[model samples]
Target chain A: MKCRKLKDSLSAYISEELSERQMSRMSRHLATCSACAGELASFKRLYERIDAVPQVLPSDDFEERFWRKVKDADAGSSSVKALPLFDWTLGFKWGVSVAVAVVVMVGAYFYLHTSYGDKARGKSEIAEMADIDRYLEFYKNYEVIKKMDFLIKLEKDKSLGDNNLPENRTL
Target chain B: MRYDRDTQLMLAFKRGDKKSFDILFKRYSVLLINYIYRFLGSRHKAEELAQEVLLKIYLAKDTYRPKAKFSTWVYRIATNACLNELRRHEYHHHSVSLDASGEENPVNRKVWMDDQAFTPEQSMEKRGFEEAFKEALKTLPERQKAAFLLNRFQNASYSEVAGALSCSVASVKSLIHRATVGLKDKLKDYII
Candidate 1:
């Protein structure tokens, strides 16, 4: 491998992540190339320095402060939920009020219509009964008038001739 | 069985056992803080970010499934939190000096000398090298930095790094390789 190619693979070589064939080629290149070998050594030293950085610990009150923050967040969220609940209650109240007003208007319309219909029906029935009574009175007067007409016809016949009126004195 | 303890502890916490959460917090707090410190390069910010991450884990307990390893799940959450923090600040401009003279800075207390027994001059040189290494790390792109940190510092395999990063293993390898090349270029002064 050329020095450029070998240098490109240096990270993988140092990390031990290369395939066996590539590792063998890189090893051969490094054996013959003093500059690449020096580069690999430097990478190793750098890795060591990176690993040697110290671990820093937090303050004594870290846990206490963290829990306090969590509690504050929970409180804030609950208050946010309360605002929506209030809006929902207000909406429900308005909806119910509008429904009651609509129902009352419909009921009043039906009640007025039914009362007018009942008054018109009662007037028509009174007119029909008066007509029936007037017809019955006219029928009774006609029967008396017909009997008078028969008696007048019998008197005229007796004045004309007694012989023409024989054996019919009951007429 | 290796991860059963943490898994059970997480499951218990999911079931509303608050004390189990405390135990989980104690176990991973320092580790997560240090990991975030590496990403942000500031102890104070790292601790704050770590607390946020733990709080997220606590709040999202119901979403936790024991299918994957507990450490992997926690690291995934921590990784996302650190990335978000980094993006929010447009990259932490406050550089933490490894050689800052203060008794409180633990990084300054633990020197990174190559030899176990070093003279004062070697310790000072190692400190300079560590500072340069940190600077080089800061220059890397976020994903590459995450890949390198998880692979090298956290001792995660390429596949595990992929899982935490939500990327393929091949992508992680490419990222770490590019990061290594970048670091080698930046720290050429110390190395060669």
Candidate 2:
């Protein structure tokens, strides 16, 4: 196998994850290849150095501190449970506030909607009434309005008659 | 037998046996501390986080189910705790001042180098390597770091790591491989 392929298999080989056939092939390659063998040794050494890093231990009173935390947590949880009424009241207050806000919003929406609808209807009614009044006023002067054209023709004829006079005539 | 013991102890703890809970704590506290230390690179933070993990285990006893090994569950919790702690701003901002003089200073805390009997030169070399390794470890992606640490430090099998990481075994292998490559590349200068 080429060194590149052998290098890819090096980690699995070092970790002992390679299959027997692959492992044997890798072993053979490493035997013949000095560079691959050196790489493997370096990997092994790195692993050893990593393994050699010392483990840090907890202090002697780790248990004591842990149990104290447990006790405190236990006490805190119990004290929280002790205020059942307060918890319920808090929930109740939030519910009531949300309900009140929702109700106010809904009521305001309906009120505004109804008022707007009423105002729109009232405006249309007033417009209709105004149209009726206008029509009535026109009808009230219907005869006079109907004679206006004749009156205008008579005035035109009179003016024509006046114009026929020499002083009023355009040459 | 080892597998069953932890599960059994957890079951007993769930059944209100306080002593069983104590036994579980005593058994895993050091391991959890060490595991978290690898992630946080701070012994103080690791101990604090380990305490939190134990507290979580204690409080969550009622929710315990025997679906998997108890160690896997513990590790899952510890891993999550470490990740959460890493996410905090304090974790990124905090530094260990070696010359700092205070009880609260992480530098004053006991470290692995303190307990080892080494020549001064050897100790300095080990400390240097450890610091370099930690820096390289910090550069790894979270999942890769978790997989590598669980597989290498915790001695968890790839399958166990997968279970702890909530990923498939294939993904765990990929994560560990990638982490190893990354660490190797970063620590190349230090490695002989």
Candidate 3:
């Protein structure tokens, strides 16, 4: 085996997971190639460092806690088997939230876009109220101007006998 | 015994022998804790998740099957639990230093003991190397990390790792190789 071929097998070789024939080939290559041997040493040291990591033990009450959970599981319902099976519950929750949001949005759309929400109608109503206020103000200022300008013009036209009114004209 | 020691025990429990289940628990609870602790890098999380696995095994008493080794089955459940958790949450690697003699951490507090105790400088260097190893492990993809840890550290044979990971032996080999190379790249400074 060339250095390149055996380079990739270094990890597997150290792990002894390689085929016996492959392991023999790599062992021969390592004996011949000083570079591969040093790389092999590096991989070995790395493994040693990893193996040297101290063991992490559980708490003193680990057994007590585990037995308690077992008892609880026996007494209560069995949900562990159902854990991965209920992925639909998450989808269902999202569906509900989206539905509620859509309903609110549609309601707001109607509220803001319907006939009752017309800005034109609101403006017209405001104008009508303003016209009534104007008239009331003028009537308050007038002494007895019960005869308005249009009414005076009509009366004068009748007194003068002017029956030939302009076409499409209205009195 | 239909299966290995654990499977026999599981089958015994299946036939109304609760004491067998107790034996299984004693044998695996700490081992599972240690395995998950390395996988998750959190002792508390490992302890909690190991109990969850135990609960899963206990629940399997009634409907247990001896398809594989009992340890393989338990590790399958554990690996799934760990992977599911990793999917749900981002794992932050918390590596403890050896120099913190005042640390209340159990892993850091108890270390290698010898007649010639480690000097403070040597302790610091060891701490750096340990943290670097953890960081390197943190960089591996979840499946690759699972395969490597199972084979190199957890004493699972290649076929056992395959069973636990639900993959083939070829894939386990490839994953372990990639993980080893990744570690080499990350720990190049300490490789000498």
Find the candidate with the highest lDDT and give its number: 2
For residues B5-81, write the lDDT of model 3, one tens digit per residue: 88998889989999999998888887888788777777898999999999989898888878888888888898888
Candidate 2 CAPRI classification by DockQ = acceptable
lDDT score of residue B64 within candidate 2:
82
* lDDT of candidate 1 over A1-171, digit per residue (tens): 478767867877888877899999999988998999998998897777667766677899988899899999888767867787567666798889999999988877755576544454566567668888988888777866766766676568767764464454442
Cα shift from native, residue B182, model 3 (Å): 1.3
Q: What does candidate 2's lDDT look like per residue over A58-130, in tens digits?
A: 7888878888999899998788688866677677988999999999998777656775654645665786689
**TM-scores vs. true structure, each candidate:** 0.59, 0.63, 0.63
Candidate 3 chain B least-lDDT 10 residues: B107-116
Tell me the spans in candidate 3 whose CA falls farther than 4 Å from its real position.
A77-171, B91-126
**On TM-score, who's better, 1 or 3?**
3
- Please give the lDDT score at residue B33 for candidate 1: 87
Better of 1 and 3 by lDDT: 3
Query: What would you estimate as the lDDT of candidate 2?
Result: 0.76
Tens digit per residue, CA lDDT, model 3, A114-161:
755445347657866898999999987573365366557767888999
- Mark the 10 consecutive residues where model 1 chain B has the least summed lDDT: B107-116
Q: Model 1 - which docking category?
A: acceptable
**Model 1, position B102: C-alpha lDDT score:** 38
Steric clash pairs (candidate 2): none
